[model samples]
Target: MKREIENKSKKKVIIKRQDECLRPSIPQFSVFEIIRATNGKLIAGSDDLSVSGVSTDTRTLSRGNLFIAIRGKNFDGHNFINQAIVKGAQAIIVESDFRFDASQGASRINKDNLSLKDCASVSFIRTDDAIGALCNLAAFHRRRFKIPVVGITGSCGKTTTKEMVADVLSAKFNVLKNKGTFNNSIGVSHTLLGLNKEVDIALVEMGTSNFGEIKRLAEIVAPSIGIITNVGYSHLEFFKTIDSICNEKYDLVKNLKHPFIAILNGDDMRLRKKAKTSKDLNLFTFGLKKTCDFTATNIECARGVLEFSLNKKHRFKINVLGRQNAYNVLAAISCGVIFGLNYKDIKNKLSAFIMPSTRISLKKIRGYHVIDDTYNSNPLSLEYAIQTLSEFDTKGKKVFVMGDMLELGKRSVMLHREIAKKIIKSGIDTLITVGPLSHHAADAIKTKKRSNLKVYSCGCTLEARGILLNLLRDDDLVLVKGSRGMRMEEIIEDL
Candidate 1:
């Protein structure tokens, strides 16, 4: 009787296994697909083999993953290939000329005297350039999903605009956005590769400092829609002039294939000029002016919340503080409208969208109102932040803790002095400058000899923190901003 019962249970198990085998499964990439995408030589690995996922960092590599060794400034990922293999990376992509050096522990012996290759079923792929190959693979993956990709680029407000656009679009579709401010080549590639059949839209932010960067990113993104927030003096050290910056940023629009939408900031003179000449593209303009295709009017800001109407018909509100953010919202709304999202849905999504941290986030520390904009800064963003700070309703004195706006090259001193002039005009009662370039600002203040203002110049963030700790008052509203290298957020942390 017991044998008869065991036979019945085995039959049931076999029937269930057969049912699962008959079910259709999602098609995953084969080894040949990776070879085709990367144009790489299969050093070791079967053509029919499949990997679970792709990764660059060995620390996070899981079983059946494909690892691409990226060579960065401080670390060479080739050094970690052995660890990745031990952690169960099924395949590895390395430079074509990379060699397995015995001194670097590339070889291991097993109890049966088998080599590393004989002991495990790992595969090796060789590419002429590992990073380029990774990007190619990502582009290939992106091609499989036929979703709308919105590529955003500009010197400032790219991240904020990307977030707002993603939020508004999420109301109608499943959205995949660039995480944080990862807007560089590696970042954009990784973001594009994250797409799958589930995603309905991709919002990518492209950031650049020199020529060809935006073009390369755009080629990989192949966006159906492009957004240029506004050109500014962000990376002048590398670009040298505003014209060069504009040319680099406009690459996104230039790369967009026909039957695409190009959103321009009508208020930005450079973009406005470009829109005039771009007759071949489907152009949409958004700004405060009524002439814009999508216009925001009747603007109001109270208690750090912004309320505005689009063409005097669609009303929207955002909690982020600053009039500059209103332009970003307008850009997002224009994108939503282009995607056929109703104004009501766009407004509802944006109204609940929270601002990204460290981009003009307002907070109360101890008892002081602190405007933290220290993620990164250039002349244009600094001016907007200072202007916003000046307009805030404050019974107490307004103070600014500023650091060097880096990458200005030869124009650093001139720009710093210009900022000092703006600071003086903004009615700031107290100013603390950090970093070497900011010394020019302090000198400009001294040259002006304002009796009502107090100025302090510090060599580094630590010194700035000490001075701010002693100088800050409970009633003061302080604004802190600087380039990423200056780490201006330290003062805010110390306070």
Candidate 2:
């Protein structure tokens, strides 16, 4: 009788498995949740629906993902909606009044004899604006998690500082950080949507070229901790002035509610002033100065490593080749301190932290020392790079290869001339420049009539590369830097 009962139980379990195989798994975000988050109108599909993920690009859209069609200056996402659906997109969020042409058959979509039921099977939600709706949805998704989100913004070192902060936090938490330069509205939204129960923290790096950009991003992220690396003369074409840049960058900290900490660069005069006057902010400061809450002293740079003492006691070393990184390290240390991390653990983590590529990356090429700072450039960053090159001990000539710093607007000439003065004063042996604005720097050097200085202004990267190849000597220390548009890294490749 017992053996008969066991056989009956096994049969019942097998029948339940067969029934489960007949049904499919549901997606993560229900159709109602999408409508609520984006305030979108459901054009088709059942109300009880869900998606496995959210995607902006049809090329990478996975099966059961919600495709958001975002329109940009050069490309329209509306044109790719059909393609997204064909690629197994579970649903699509688009602008209102978007027309669906069944004639254009997508990969999985059957064009001929398609009906409302076919459209309903692949859900469609329409909003007033697709990008705005994406931001709304990301904001809603972010609220689902209560983990700490750290937002970093500045004219320079935002990316590096973001990476450092994430590395420090990863010592105790599973960290999710903005990849590459994904700090804009669309990028931040995608990053926020990636947050799940597994992630312990999110380090978001925000970048902007115009006013009110940071404010919009801040509203979406609502960071628990805000960090401003430093306010510098970057994107002056839109910001117009350093004070304007400061106001724009400060929006991140300004948007945070009470019970949040503002990590500020105490070395920056504007931020220092703001820290002094800003009321009701839980502020923590970091810099090389003694006044900062987290300070670094006894700094040393040798063979592409930066060693410094934190708070005049704890010693730390980072394997990056820039003295300006000291400020970035100090900022990260402030964060670790705020989070109750011990000094020893913070030092251990920082020691293993490596800098992102193309930002002051030191390399050796064919018996020449190359400092590739070609990722991006601004007045402040250019000055720092120039100083770093000057400080390096070199056997052969010290060469400075530069390109124009774009988006400076009316200040382009003045800023380049200012950089020219620094180059001349730095005692660099050779200065090779490219681009039209960089001519201002070469001209500034020519006006000085320094017989010891060799200045060459090339019209393009090819010409610059030829000049560098002919001039480079064994053991020469060369620093290549420029704006992203200039593609300064190509010069290094050519050499």
Candidate 3:
């Protein structure tokens, strides 16, 4: 999986991950087809032209790539048209108001210059919105296939459930899962655009930080089945209440047409209530609760594995440390069962499923057991991490090095401080805070007056790293985590 992150210098930094494939499994398309999908007017080059694939950044543009001039809060792709042409873009999709200049591979665009030889080398599409054109074209191409598409979403466990569902389906079919947390409208479009003949199923993970994103993604995915892991305190900056989060995630189920399957987390009473009114769906629920269609029992974690029994009959052991993963596993298993896979096959497939290193990983470093979950953080996941720490059998004191959890909106500080209650019960000996919000957690813990616990607050990750380096002992167990901006990995990377 490859994702683009912009640094302080305004340059795009591409990080390539090992678990997922970043290379294109894309099919080729003709200029006329793209124009038809995008409702674009051809301005230059022959309508018969073809492009190998699509790209947004000139830094990675290949010779036959169709470049879309997408505008963002910080940068505009239109400003790099000349650079894209020099990098060998076969076509360009620009806004309707974009006027061509001589530097755009040929002389300034005009009716008389439509047949210019220089401009003929590159095709052009003028659309009202470039980003909308990209999604339109992708949805058009997606209409070409009639395979089973599974759309997965939730506040937490979306990626894990998506990966596990993909792994289970891959045992019997060729599956293409969206890479990483690329669950935005743009990322979902890219996944649909990559569909080809060899794929039997498309597993798309949808994420939303605001309203309407899930509905838009569902409009593109047209899923045969949808999985919602759980709606919790995620993206609370935009979605202020749990009820709003519930409604936002339910868009996946509501947008689906008749006769579609809706899989939900049964333990979430909110989802269960939603499922009651959704009588039109072929509903399935999974969790640790007995009433669920698929439920796990005898949950246990030892070393680096999680063991659970489904429906009190079939047993499964997966490579993971978090007992909270039982919910994610049950969701994946429910999907496999709905897809007509036998319990034997599902068991074999799931037993071999190794969650991506990005989710969470337990490692040994210099005689210390380190749990790294620095990908991103939210209240529910943080609570689960603390529970895992509390249950762990450590030879030395258990320590939690947490940074601020972002996107909580007005309740940001309260939520941080709220997590202090979980920390007190976790039996962890030390807490190191790394941001202003996390400072609230430190203050709350101090108010409790826990004599056995020690706390430290720092303004930055570097200061936290220095504190940890001096505070840790030989056999201590440590967990490091934060939201994307806090860079919490600094505490464990070298220590």
Query: What lDDT is obtained when candidate 2 is compared to the true structure?
Result: 0.84
Which has the better lDDT: candidate 1, or candidate 3? 3
TM-score of 3: 0.91
Per-residue alpha-carbon lDDT of model 2 for 1-495, expressed as tens digits?
Answer: 001111101221110101111212222688899999889998767668788888899888898889999999999888887677667778899898786554433322555344445555788889999999989988988877666788999999999999898889788777888889888999999888878767767888999999999999999998878999999999999989999999999988888854467889987889878766777677777888887777889999987889998877888989988789999998888777666567788888999998888999889999999999999999999999998998888889999999999999999999999898899889799999999999999999999999899999999999999988999989999999999999999998887
Q: Provide the lDDT at 45 for model 2.
A: 70
With a 3 Å backbone cut-off (N, CA, C), the pairs that clash in candidate 1 are none
Q: In model 3, what are the clashing residue pairs, if there are any?
A: none
Candidate 1 per-residue C-alpha lDDT over 78-168 given as tens digits, one digit per residue, 9 for 90 to 100: 8887677777877888997896443333334343244656424766788999999888888887777656788999889999999999999
Clashes of each: 0, 1, 0
Stretches of candidate 1 above 4 Å error?
1-28, 101-120
